[model samples]
Target: MARRPLVVIGSGLAGLTCAWASDPQGCILLTAGVLTDGAASMWAQGGIAAALSPDDSTALHAEDTWRAGAFAGDRAVIDRITGVAPEVVRLLVELEVPFDRAPDGSIDLALEGGHSRSRVAHAGDHSGAAVTTAMARAVRAAPHVEVREHHTVTRLLADASGAVCGVEVRRRDGSLEVIETDRVVLATGGMGGLWAHTTNPTTALGQGVALAARVGARTDDLHLVQFHPTALDVAADPMPLLTEALRGAGAKLVSDGARFVDELQPRDVVAAAVWEQLTEGRTVRLDARGINRVATRFPAVAELTAASGLDLTRDLLPVRPALHYSMGGVTVDDTGRSSVPGLWAVGEVSRTGLHGANRLASNSLLEAVVTGRAAAADAITWTGVWRGSVRPADPATVRTRTCTAAPAASRPLPLAQVRETLDSACGVLRDGPTLQAAVDCLEPHVGDDAAYVAWLIARSALAHPLSVGAHRRTDNVLPEGVSA
Candidate 1:
């Protein structure tokens, strides 16, 4: 019998956690970049959502999650996740993650937008980075896990029976290799990087979504994309995120010294308010000056602001909405089983109905941990039944076809064009005319990597006629029949 490999793709929290939980004696973890380099998890500052507060209950957390999801969430999935959240937090603590603590030695919690209680566990403002680094360290020390860098998965290969058998990946040197495996897991993050202005890393190009869609996976809710309201509008092109924890700590969203909107509103409300202000010729700013005394409470935000040449005592940071999270992807069950056999998805890449139309504050990290572990357990059970019959596919030898002449290198899309089109047509406002115009303007570059992402975004945006959660349309208002 041949040795079977369990291949896990993407190196973010979801992928790493799955690898750790699978405990596959010799599983291989493949990633396109540094484990922490391109993941949105490292950029998360608000912390993980869990019912760790004595005053809070899982029912309350579930209620808030369902509300933020615009009532489209699956109650069963929500209950399961909320019920298991405390254990997930415990697992992170056991992994040696340095969570912030109170003077009395209790775990400190913070509040963020769309939450009724202070139940978020954080490490100041660097919660995601701390958790990711801790997990990466543990994975590295584990003798059974193998981490492969600079490998990008191009396509998922299926056997004659239409089950996923392995993956075809492009190496750093542009060579392709097929890794035959009995099980494959996709932990690729969201599609925020597809937009011109996003807080996500450049590597988040919807490769996983595209690959799964191409392979006939049932994807849902692709129209819903969450926009974070406070991406610092500085010299940075993609913009840096100012965590929602600042608002939860009493920072105000003001324009010209007047409070323009409720600071504690859900992300979509805040983002739309800012967009309205921008359209009205008023510059939107997040007022953190009043919270300067509490600056020591959030070391990460304070340090980052200082490094960016802004003084919390005097400066009102300019901000704008940027692509933050995706509430859509390949559909999956509570156990992370995809529509296809021998394949699973977890984290941001999988639409497990936990987030519904929009994700609640700080819930992404929790979802990743819970579903990641479940996927691994499912894989273990699956291997028990299928391992005996699985065989590695033989490498096919074929001659490479060479072109007679070299074609000219195509010029990259102009930055100005990319930004203008998205801002005008696909920003906070949308209509039949604008979406059609956007599709026309971006159609020529559809085959381009960035253009494909833009295309998928627009298509998804156009598919749904009603505006829900993070998605808003000037022509369409919230439906009266739908209950929140």
Candidate 2:
């Protein structure tokens, strides 16, 4: 029997978890950039959501997740993920992940927005970093996994019968290669980089969603983009995130010399409040003085503030709302299976309805672990019954086309124009006229870089007339009927 190959795309928690669970003897892992580059998994400061506390049950965690998702979440998926979270955390611990522990040697937990209890297991303020680094180390040591850096997947290849077979990749050197495989898993991160101001790496340009869409996969809830309420507004272009855990630790948000607002509000509400402050010509600041004594509790936050030339003890760190996560992407089933046969998606790349209209704090990473592992198990079962060899196609013979590709002589729209248009029309506040204008402006450059991203965001935003979660439309005020 010929050896079957499993191809996993992206190097974040979801991709890494799938690779680890698949246990494929000789698997090929494709990443668009370096392991640490452009991955939202590394930028995450909040801890993972799990039922680690004796007071916290999986039912409570699931309920919280469902509530935070605006009741649009799939209940079965929520239950499945929350149920496995504790075990997933334990597995990470056994892998040598140094999660912060209590004095009694139990896992330390913290609270964040939308949660009823302190059920977040963290590693200081760098939980995502700690888990990502640890997982990457394990992946590197695994003899069966082959990590391919700087390989961009341009398209997913499906057979004439509409079954996924492999992918066409554009290498770092601008050369193309086709890798044949029996199964493919997309773990690519979110579409935050498409926005002007975001905490995600610039490389997260909705490539995964676009690629999946190109292959005729069903996508869902594309308008739901989460905005972090407190990204440090400094010289940083993409912006630096100040974790919500700071609020959990008692930090407050206030305008210049004014009273502070409640710090425990939902991210969408808090982000909108911060945006309103900015629109009113008032700079927002995160007051850390009250929580300065516990600054040692969050070493990463303290170190980042100090590195940015601000002393938590004396100076207030400037903050603003920035695009953070996407609650939509290629649609997947309960087991992370996409509509396309032989293909699965996990993590931020797949819109499994687990997040619905809004994502709960820290649940993004939890979904990645749970769905990645489930996808791997499902893929193994799928490949067992489906036996077919995929032959590589000649690079020159296969069409080298792009959704944005135009005639060689035609001048393409500039990226700067697209960015400015999105910033002005499709940003924090939206009206029907402005959104329509945005669609009109983006229609001309449909296949262009900025236009493609703007198209997805604008179209999706337009589809959901009611305001929900991070997406807000001034013209279409959400009806009272739509309750959270």
Model 1 local distance difference test score: 0.78
Structural RMSD, model 1: 5.7
How does each model score on lDDT?
A: 0.78, 0.79
TM-score between model 1 and native: 0.89
Best by lDDT: 2
TM-score for model 2? 0.91
Worst 10-residue stretch by lDDT in candidate 1? 397-406
C-alpha lDDT of residue 373 in model 2: 84
Off by over 4 Å in 1: 24-26, 383-423, 440-449, 477-484
